[model samples]
Target: MGPGNRPLDLEWLEDFLALAESGNFSRAAQARNIAQPAFSRHIRALEEWVGVDLFDRSAHPAALTAAGRRFQPLLEETLAQLESARIKARAAHDQAAASLLFAATHVLSLTFFPQWLGGLESQLRLGPIQTISDSFHACEDLALQRRVQFVLCHGHPEVPGRLDEAEFPMLRLSDDVLLPVSAPLAGGGGAMHSLDAAEAAVPVLAYSEPSGLGRIMRARMRQVFGEGSSVPTLPQGVDIVFTAHHAALLKAMALEGRGVAWLPRSLIAAELKSGALVAAASAEWNVPVEIRLYRQRADMAPAAEALWTLVQERPPGSGGR
Candidate 1:
């Protein structure tokens, strides 16, 4: 409410502040980019709205009255709060427009996401990105619940997961291989653990059920080995030493010469090259998998949609490392 109980014009508040700061009507009018008479009218309207005089006109420098002195601080505080609210509202809108949200499995988040995002940045402009790295099931849940724009994880066409079952749109970004690897023996002669060993039961570092790689390995191992085989088969038997949902965790245990573990080739390429980790089995045991990005079928943010378009335009193996 304002003078005559009409709505107040926000410009009048600005005029009041300007006049209070300058302490001169003409100077304040010039500062506010309005004519002197118009600015004076704005100040008068504001005073009427407040139901009191705000300036002592007889003072040498047009000083504030006691009421004006009290009003100045309250007005300054109110204006400051409104400006803050305006800034926050704009910032939130901008963030919603420019931000990208992703949920990636632990392995891909570490081994693949940074490089893949760098490659995309070269082709398109991306804003702030938020990535959640967790187990496959967690990433799947984010995608299913519409909490993120994309999910990056290993997938096999033969073994469809929840995202696939829900018919979420996905792009096969790259190819990856999960292969058996073991730390080298003490004398550096060969791998410490071997799938073909015929001695005591072979120790195995395996994936838990929550891991996407675990699901793929279990399903494919059944096809490669007999119907009942879950992990890679040893000539004698396999003793499950440890189970985890993270490939990097299994890689650490494998590097310590703990047991034979199936790890992604991309993740252990440096180790394989340096002979820190060696092939525990032949190439026939390697499982080929796809590094896939899944998203909801509905429209997404502009940046996400643009990224998906660029990925589709590129060649199949261009982004794989």
Candidate 2:
């Protein structure tokens, strides 16, 4: 069958628009952050799919042919209509689903969510759960987009979450501490590194920007070490040797004796009990945080509302371990 008979790709249409706007293949490709060859292929594929010559190849800056000019308005309108339909469909699907969607940071998704969900199951029979485990930044994005019913992450009232308090209601679920820790020395003598030590630099395994714990750590460090403290920055007494998005990965690195890491105490409880990890700094340096759940201002699925209500009814210091 000819290209005209096949399904059209919206991406190609977008490419066509980009190429038309830029007036040069190389410029459009650069703007789109795609290789020039790939951009040319997209344009060619678009033309082939439409079975129309959209651009004048001989023109110095790639002027559009008659067919191209005529197709532009129709393509624009079609794309807009398609986008509107997609948004409406997604909203309807979200409204119709009985289950709750949660976006949780990786560490909490592993350590806290299962236990919390188990506890809630006895109180309320949740229909089905859809949880996305990701970095705090990604979870925030999901919550902001209203793609998920809830966002669960470590929140420090001192350092606000990405979602504005006015737009998203928050419930403090539990209290957790960010503990500065490192692997015990050989033969389990002592911690491999200490923040208190007057060493040249304390090698550290740090978290990437996307991590909630990383944000908390950076905020706390700034408060403790003054404004000079920032992630991977050369603070007066510390040096960040490595950076990662996952707290579990940083904990693993700390266990390997690579460097000190500030890990959630809940996550490394087993390791701490086994004498594999030790506090790298005093209690004074530890950052206190809350395990919080955030929801949009708008109403959610009934199951999600019930879950939220159940959580709110819990007395202070009841749910957290």
Candidate 3:
């Protein structure tokens, strides 16, 4: 006999099970779409391998031997399991192709994801996908409702715990950089050098609601500027002042110098590199945030798996500004 612990050859096991069910070599051969002689040879091989007589050839209409009778249930169970496995494999290959939904905060979504996704889309060969852009809270609601496969957003209290419930990990998807920026000064003089020393009236534009970056900025402001000195609403002192969607827009306003804008480094890399924009602060304590991705814990479908792999394959060190 073959090594007792060796895994069964499924194809041979299946042929044996079919032959047992049909009870005739010719009929079993027809069911399997093979020649009768070939079927007989296969069964003989199986019997020799198992070291047992499976059929009583001398009997009319072919009957199972005592050993065959004892093996019947196990053989039938194995066939049934094989059938179930085939169905599941087919589903994963076809019917279970993943439909995808992704949401991101405005800044990261607007600034870098287009390029990242352009790279990702080239790899996906299957399934429908939808990407939503909205406030961080909206992403949360969609993720909670199972409307989206993943959410991309900045820091939030719900974080990894929220993803854990769905059996997904919160991956640090990108490194983002934040900077204070302003348009070229009128006399070609550089803009504000210090948040305090600069004209206090220079309106700092910020989000109207408590948002992911909004909360971070609000807390940091209080800690740094003393209590009750937060910059008031959008365009507070002038109509041209700062504010808008993610940091991309925030950085855009900074380019015009309506007021100082805090924005991601990736958002302004082009301008910064070309000398069109300037970094706001050099202090490491001045900026901290990251872009993140979330996925479900259940068996990931092909499309989701494809996207997940593409997202992970990005070169590391892309900042969460």
TM-score of each: 0.69, 0.70, 0.55
Query: Considering only N, C-alpha and C atoms within 3 Å, which residue pairs clash in candidate 2?
Result: none
Q: What tens-digit string does per-residue lDDT give for candidate 2 at 1-321?
A: 249467776778888999889889999999888899999988988888878789998998999999999999999999999999999999877655738899999999999888888888889989878899999999999988888889989889888876855559988888888888988888877799877663568888888889888887777787333475533333346677999999999999998999889898889999999999999877877778899889878988789999999999986446546
What does candidate 2 score on TM?
A: 0.70
What is the clash count of model 1?
Answer: 0
TM-score: model 1 vs. ground truth? 0.69
Candidate 3 steric clashes? 11
Q: What is the C-alpha lDDT of each candidate?
A: 0.87, 0.84, 0.65
Which regions of candidate 3 fall more than 4 Å away from where they truly are?
Answer: 1-98, 121-127, 156-168, 192-196, 199-202, 224-245, 282-285, 309-321
Top lDDT: which candidate number? 1
Q: Judging by lDDT, tell me the better candidate of 1 and 2.
A: 1
Candidate 1 per-residue lDDT, tens place, 233-320, comes to: 5557778889999999999999999998989988999999999999987887788999999987899988899888898898766874
Q: Model 2: which ten-residue window has the lowest total lDDT?
A: 228-237
Ranked by TM-score, top first: 2, 1, 3
Q: Rank by lDDT, descending?
A: 1, 2, 3
lDDT against true structure, model 3 = 0.65
